[model samples]
Target: MGINLQKGQKISLDKEAGGGLSHIVMGVGWDAATGKTGMLGGLFGGGGGNIDLDASCLMFDEQGNQTDAVWFRQLRSRDGSIQHTGDNLTGEGEGDDEQIKVDLSAVPANVKSLVFTVNNYTGQDFSKVANAFCRIVNGANDSEIARYDLSCQGSHNAMVMAKLYRHNNEWKMHAIGETGKGRTFEELLPQIKPHL
Candidate 1:
């Protein structure tokens, strides 16, 4: 089982995995909040409709400048170190709805951090999203290392979910469940700076 992380919590990937990790998969999942009790039903005049949430990875240098991004519009980063699987239109079935793959060793030397984010591209606030979560999986063995729940109900449409950063040549995961308003990752750049 993987550790359940709270907002602002940080964990060393090396220690959690028992050693260094070469490849990792960051998975994001969610389900549309159902019933009239849900925010969507109360606020948006609807209930149990599809929510299109997008998962993205933003790479940054030591200076906190965005170096590259891998998102729905751009499936792969410039250096090819990160790749987004695809976009999931409906917050539907089972496990992860979307995933981003990262090659830690292949990441450019200048890149110091990788920030993960989720945005409601369809503009539905998180109150309508249920069971939202982001998890880190050891790509080699398909074992989850850690997970952060993002099911907090709110009016915000985007969340700076978590980040993976280089520390002493090792990578660490930090949970930052900062909610904000944005339809895309680019709009959340300012909100992501302080955390880096």
Candidate 2:
């Protein structure tokens, strides 16, 4: 269901040319009716509401299944690779802001590329989502790469599937779709996948 990124390992946008490292900006957005859509206030969230009670909930137990809300994914040119990850949940502000750090040195041998993703965790109420968009760039030098846009807007929070890019290119910013419901990872998954 997700990819886990540790300390080391990665791939380049261009293997022969050497995939320059950058910041991939994955952003997700949606109109929400959640009150106290920030930290602390969500502590009161329970069954009556769907907001998470914790502000630092990168992962949570959804319907008895333990899933990580935050993660990092990589694609290897040799063995199978993970192109996306889970950003968990953060009911802090307007968007469900989550980030995964990237280092050129972190690219593992044979790795080709990567995709940063956010997990959705909305209950059985969101079914009106439309799209998920992603932007790539070298966060340090601020170089941008190709972008992937989809019509995936939904009724609840969503898991930013991922902003994919080649490793040999100048990598950078990533934008994951955030349509509300950041209190928990499970409640935010719907914003990314409309059919999920």
lDDT of 2 by residue, 1-196 (tens): 1122212223233331235433333333333234423455456542224322121112212232223333423222122221233433333455323434344454444333343343344442233222233334444554444344423445444344443333234432233433455534445445433312
TM-score of each: 0.94, 0.38
True-structure Cα RMSD, model 2: 11.7
lDDT of each: 0.92, 0.35
Q: Highest lDDT, which number?
A: 1
In the range 104-172, model 1's lDDT, one tens digit per residue, is 999999999999999999998998898999999999999999999999998899999999999988999
Candidate 1 C-alpha error for residue 85, in Å: 0.7
